[model samples]
Target: MKKFKKFLIWLVGIILVVLIAGAAYLHFSAYQPSTAANQAVKVAAEDNQETFFKAKQNKLTVIFYPGALVTPNSYAIWAKKVAQAGYTVKIVHFPLNMAFFKVKAADKVVNSNENYVVGGHSLGGAMAARYAHQSDNPHLKGIFFLGAYPDEKGRLDQKKLDVLSITASRDGVLNWSKYRQGKKYLPKTTEYYQIKGGNHGGFGSYGQQKGDRKATISNGRQQTIIAKKLIAWLRKIK
Candidate 1:
């Protein structure tokens, strides 16, 4: 009995030491400054570009929701890209990760705009879909989901599904089985794009985590590519 107790104590001590060391390393690692506070900053587009933002004031509006526990600032760059592509972009922040909380916040920002395209990163994408599906807005353009899955419903409305776009990669946090099951509720024409080399957490709007610079660079490249494609897709529809 005494020997067993000693063994357990040694195991606990080893685990504690490892955890402390890892925490220290991560804290001291290369960390990028967060630009999350600049959520309202819009990116400038090319001259003579036929984007939705320039076409008319009543043009389609695209709203971006950040991932779980993330701020809208993380998706600012991506939102600006879409805005540049001609869609008026708005990034809505939820008080918490709950969609119920986000829905009310987003409602204030929508203001009866008919042509709205709602999208999000990770769990935020799921929240956006839930809002659009449950709302009475017929003018909603479409939904773009990034690294997220449709909720319990095997169905999103046909109108929204017609314009749905699912962008995910192997590294993303999607449960393919659950995602596939939800597809039954979506429009048969919904587009799906698999982002290569992307992770479920890394593709989020938030900036890179404090870690190896190489990993950060790789994730940044993938995210940039995803953002560009999103802008292109939004422009084509606008």
Candidate 2:
């Protein structure tokens, strides 16, 4: 009997160690903002650790979630560009830097008086779509994804919300098969854009990510293209 107890204790200890090591890997694997993106963080406003970038507040707001293992500040450059075009943007900071942990976190950021949209990059975008699919918030007008798409459960074929999907021609990190399958989940009115020569990491100011294809275009050029697309989408939301 004593031997069995000892074995049980040993097994529990090994499981704990493995869990701790896995957590540490996730922490260390987070993508950090580049110097320029880091510097831009200074202008951002904070609400309970969530970051906001609004040069001029407007009737429309965008709530963004970071991709898995991506720091929120990594998206400051993109947020700034959208904000400059007269929209308020809030970037959610997730526990463990993963958006799936807080799929409906956008609820706290929405205002009944303002028209709103939710979006994100990579896995963040998927989680945002999950929230959008299940939410009944009347203020939600649209959703935009950056190199990401919804899973089966986030179906929006009958939803009234507008959808915009932006992808990179050179992106190797995104699952193309899943992207194709995700088309059935989007509304009939969904719009799509692809950035030529851009890679997955170019969507944000973070440096190249592991397992992503090399981008043939400069980050500035890629960002500009994304900004233009976002601005054009925003203009149509009214």
Candidate 3:
């Protein structure tokens, strides 16, 4: 019995060590923002407020969450494009660069008086859906996802929220089986799009992801397509 107890203790210690090592890797190996994304627009940062691209009129607001281990600035190019097209955009930074660390991070930046849409990429998108499912914000007009899907807990189908889900045809990082299963959680009216020749990393200005498939399209082309589709959707909402 003493020997068995010693083995159990050893196993527990090994597991804890592995968990800590993985967390450290995630924290240190986060994706870096591209130079073009950095130069595309001047992001506004305020104390305790989310980093944002502010439009002159602020006709609409979009609060975006970054993917796991992705730096918030990696999304600057996309946000800048959207903001120039006439909507205010804010990218919420997650603790330890993971949206799962704080699923309700968007709550800090959502303005009650402004019409807004909430969305995220990969894990971030899933968390955003979870937040929208539970939030009672009257100004939240839509939910957007980039290579991400809602989990069962979101109850979006029952709530019948306006949702847009965009995925790359060659995305290798996203689990197809899980994505298919999660589709049931979305409302019947959800609009879904598959960007041909695109890959998972094309949604942001971050360099290629470790396990993602090679994108046949240029990053610029992919982002432009995303911007056009998103702008069209925003116009409809407005």
Candidate 4:
């Protein structure tokens, strides 16, 4: 019995060590934002909220969550593009650069008086869906996903929400099985698009992801396509 107790203690210690190491890696290896994109749109930072604003009033506001381990600024280019098209974009910073740590972080940026959409990439998308599914925010009209899916726990299909799910054609890092299973949880009217030649990391301007497939198209092209589609979808919202 003493030997068994010793083994159990050793196993717990090993698990704790592994968890700590993984957390450290995630902290140190987080993506850094690029400075090459010209600041044509109004970029403002407030606490964890990074806003790319246009001059238009009554514009639809989009609150975006970054993928796990990706810095919120990595999505600035896309946000700026959307802003240039006359909509307001806000990229939310998650605690520890992981959305799972703060699933309702979108609440901080949402304006209850304005029309809005909530979305994210990868794990961020899952948490965004979780927030939309659980929250009673009447301003939220839609959900967007980039190489992501709704969390199974929330089952967004039950809610009367519009959804747009965009996936990459050659995404090596996305879990196909879970993505397939997640479709059942989305509404029947969900608009789905697969960007040909795009990869998992193409949604943001961050450097190449470790396990992601190489994108066949340039990041600029991918971002342009995403912005165009998103803008079109927002216009369709009544």
Candidate of highest TM-score? 2
lDDT of each: 0.58, 0.89, 0.86, 0.83
Better of 1 and 3 by lDDT: 3
What TM-score, over all chains together, does every model reach? Answer: 0.67, 0.93, 0.88, 0.86
By descending lDDT, how would the candidates be arranged?
A: 2, 3, 4, 1
lDDT of 3 by residue, 1-238 (tens): 9999999999999999999999899889999888877776456553444778888877889999889899888888878889888999889977778888778877788765878999999999999988999988787888999999989876588774678899999998999899999999998988989999999999998889999999999988898989888888888784
Candidate 2 residue runs with Cα over 4 Å from true position: 1-10
- For model 4, the local distance difference test gives 0.83
Q: Assess the local accuracy of residue 12 in candidate 1 as a C-alpha lDDT between 0 and 100.
A: 100
State, as a TM-score between 0 and 1, how close model 4 is to the true structure. 0.86
How high is the lDDT of residue 104 in model 2?
92
lDDT of 1: 0.58
Ranking by TM-score: 2, 3, 4, 1
lDDT at 87, model 2: 85
Local lDDT at 166 for model 2: 97
